[model samples]
Target: MTIRFGLLAFPGVQQLDLTAPYEVFASMDDAEVHLVWKDTSPIVSATKLALQPTTTFAECPPLDVICVPGGVGVNTLLEDADVLSFVRKQAAQARFVTSVCTGSLVLGAAGLLKGKKATTHWNALDFLENFGAVATPGRVVRDGNLFTAGGVTAGIDFGLTIVAALRGREEAEAIQLSLEYAPEPPFHSGLPEKASVEVLGRTRQRLAGSRMARQAIIARLAAARHGAE
Candidate 1:
């Protein structure tokens, strides 16, 4: 059977977060991939890469796997009812509801990860608690049909993991080999714990604006939920 995969395409999405998994899934046998957004217009990725949507929300076919990718754009989506509605609708039937990086934040906003183990970009990991999700530290985390991954590069891992879940580990490994997916970064500072004070501080400073915005969004969402309850 052909596996239909839909990855969210939105403005300001981290290209790697979407494209890494996209490349991996596109390599799989009988995998049909779609870049879906609210419209067919072109959207700029986080790095200013121009990407066009292959399908619109109103016209998208039901997918077996639906992936939401993270970036600065996700903050805007946190309050977007249309996008959240689309996600909730797709996730209701998709065999796998997945996300990478802060994309898990979107899933949380859609109410899909409550009480589930999930992970996101390190900077936003703690924010998962606002959605009633158990924040996980794993690069890739799966809770039932919900699969979440860490920062940008982890989307590749997320893709392979999903492929393994649907196909097999051997097939996933084959695809990995085909793509030469081996990683040997020169820095041990990938994790916050290992990062030098200088590196960590610099990154924190850079992300402070977005992080603060996201925290405010989380707080607002939490307050709304509490009020509704």
Candidate 2:
């Protein structure tokens, strides 16, 4: 039997978040991976890689897994009715609903993470509470069938974990071995708390504009929700 996977593809997505997991899944037996977008056009990644959608939202199959990857583009998707509707519809039937990095924000926006323990990039963890999700700090978090990866590189770990659940530990191990998925970075700056004050400041400064934009969007959404109730 074939296990189908569909990941949301949009403009300005973090390429590694989508591709790293994709490579893991594609290594498995009888895996069907489809990049689903509004259309079949090539979308530019945040890092400028051009990726073509394999299927349209209208043409996506009954996927066993639905993955959403995060990037600067995620802020725009927070309130996109069509995108949220698509995710909610897919989640209704998908065996595993997952996201990478800030993509959890999209899942929360789709009303899928209510009261669930979830995690995103460290910088955005606090925002999870806005959606009634318990903000967790971990490399990868799984609440039932909902799996969310933390930050960027965690996507590889997230993918292997899901594959192990679906296939087997041996299969995941074999795939990991094939891909040489070992990690031991020379730097200890992966987490904000561990980073030097100078590193943190520079990184935050680089991400200032996007962070500000996301905060504004979150605040606006919160106010709108409050007014509606």
Candidate 3:
């Protein structure tokens, strides 16, 4: 079977969050990888890196897996009706719906994480409850068909886990070995709980505006959706 895996891309999307899993999917056996964006042209990342998408969100075929990536742009993308609607629709038909970093916030905005257990970049885990998800602290949390991973590099682990679920542990292990999966972080401050006071404060400040903006948009969207019904 040629598994169709769609990776959602938007302006200011995270680099590693999208690319790490893209590598994994590309290495998978007989899997078709697609980078989907709102526009048919190139999309820029938060780090100012530009990427050309293979398909538009509306044009993507029914996918075996859908991966939503997160970065600064998510502050606006979470509230984008077009993106959220597309995600909700595609996710309904996908065998697996996965997210990396704050991408879970987008999934939550799409109303796909309600009453599910999920995890995201540690700093944002508390916000997951707003979507009715049980916030998890682990690197990867698998609740049924919804898979969420922690910040940045966790996408690789998340992909391996999904591969194990889809194919088998042996297949996942083989892929892991092929990629030489090993971690050696220079800093111990990756997680909020483990970070120094200054590091945590700085990180929070950097994301504070974005988080506030997303929260406002979420409130507005919720009200609008509720009023329409």
TM-scores for candidates 1 onward, in order: 0.99, 0.98, 0.93
- Pairs in steric clash, model 3: none
Predicted candidate 3 versus true structure: per-residue lDDT over 1-229, tens digit per residue: 8889999888999999999999888888988999998777888899999999999876789999999998888888777889999999999999999999999999999999999999998768888988878998888998999999999899999889888888889988889999999888888987777899999899999988877877787688778778999
Report backbone clashes per prediction.
0, 0, 0
Model 3: residue 97 alpha-carbon error in angstroms: 1.1
Give the CA lDDT, 0 to 100, for residue 139 in model 2: 92
lDDT of 2 by residue, 1-229 (tens): 8999998889989999899899999999899999999999999999999999999988898899999999999999998999999999999999999999999999999999999999999889999999889999999999999999999899999999999999999999999999998898999999999999999999989988988999999999899999999
Clashing pairs in 1: none
TM-score, model 2 to reference: 0.98
Give, for candidate 3, the lowest lDDT window spanning 10 residues. Answer: 213-222
lDDT of 1 by residue, 1-229 (tens): 9999999999999999999999999999999999999999999998999999999999999999999999999999999999999999999999999999999999999999889999999999999988889999988999999999999999999999999999999999999999998899988999899999999999999999999999999899989988999
CA lDDT of each prediction against the hidden true structure? 0.96, 0.94, 0.89
Which prediction has the highest lDDT against the true structure? Answer: 1
